[model samples]
Target: MLSLILIGGSIFASCRKQIAVQSIPNMPVNYTIYDNSAQAIKLAKEGMLSITNVEVENTAIGYGGLLVVSRTITPSAEDLAYDLSCPYEVKQDVRVRPSKDNSFAVRCPVCGSVFNVAENGGAPIAGPAASSNSPRRMRQYRVIRQPDGIRIIN
Candidate 1:
């Protein structure tokens, strides 16, 4: 019985998907958006934004700016925030923006890679950026819901 349990645990652990470790810098993320504000409401509805050239103390990591993506998974009404940096190219400025069609995918204009932000934790669904050897996913940040707003944190 003990061996059977151990083998079962090992099989389950081995079946788990491997998470990609990106090279992007881990800078402090402390920003809030009021729920009633236009920006916040728009983000909640649209689910994506190309926040260009944001001023942050750690300019080294996000020199180009930051991209923000929001999604409301089923079973939880709260919106989740994800960093829009392309995992393939880890730089402060290399970020992804929403497609013109407003689909679930975000495209990296620099690399021509389009990632599906709403699926599989921002996995690279298509484009020139998809490589088997590369970390092909978007970095995510922590988002906490408040009574009046949502807080983004790294």
Candidate 2:
């Protein structure tokens, strides 16, 4: 009986879901965007932006510079930010871009993975990303609402 129980436990452990573990750049990220500005206003209306090749002070962390994909749920009220690099590829240059059809999805041109950014956190809806066994969602950052603007922290 003891041997059977041990075998069953081992089987269950082996069958457990595998989490994708990737190296994340550990640097301080403090980005701010003020409301009532032209860029902010436009972002409010569109609700999304594909920021690429941002030059942060520390290039050692996060793919060369900072590549971020941002979205606003309330359009000037709430902001959400995520790293744009595709988890499938660990490099920083492989970033995701917004779909051309105005869909709420971002596609990785490298691997042809489409992630639905319109929902809460960036979720893989289709393509090779959807089939990934680990690191399912895009890496997300912290967005905080401030009195004047919004602040993103990494």
Candidate 3:
């Protein structure tokens, strides 16, 4: 009984650890990109976009906006979507910009933290995001793939 309890506790703790990203100010988000849209085309080609299409759906885009990435045309899983806000900064204005050279990683101009995007899990890979005593990953939103479009919500 003790062993089983210990195992369960360990599992829960690990899950918590994975979720220990710093919090950004709360902002509701509900955005969609239709299949025929330019954003969709870019995603299908494994390109990334920093989207701030506010008022499109009467919803806030995200804390600092949205960073959407696609790894495949017809991905088996979700197309990655994350809040542009730097988790290390935890402010709506402090956004992470994707590196011009690397489409799969973004760097915070303020904190110099780099995060892996797309299929890479949005985890901090370098700089303060990784080197901080309490390291944090990027804040991700749910990417729901639909027949007509991709709906991202937070």
The digit string of per-residue lDDT tens for model 2 on 44-137 reads 7766755554444532223423333344443334466777787666567878887886457778888887776666467777776678666466
- Candidate 3: lDDT over CA atoms? 0.79
Error of 2 at 83 (Å): 1.0
Instruction: Indicate which candidate wins on TM-score.
Output: 3
Clashing pairs in 2: 20-134, 63-92
- Assess every candidate by TM-score: 0.69, 0.71, 0.77
lDDT of 1 at 61: 24
lDDT tens readout by residue for model 1, 1-154: 9999999999998888755555556665666667787767778677665555444453322333445556552124445556657666666567777888547777787877777666566677776556554546776666687899877776
Q: Against the true structure, whose lDDT is highest? A: 3
Candidate 2 deviant stretches above 4 angstroms:
1-3, 14-23, 53-77
lDDT of 3 by residue, 1-154 (tens): 9999999999997777444455666678789889999888877775677886585657668788998887462144558788998998888778898787676788999989888885555788888888876778887888888999988997
Q: All predictions: root-mean-square deviation over Cα?
A: 5.8, 4.0, 5.2
**Overall local distance difference test of candidate 1:** 0.64
> Worst ten-residue run, lDDT, model 3?
69-78
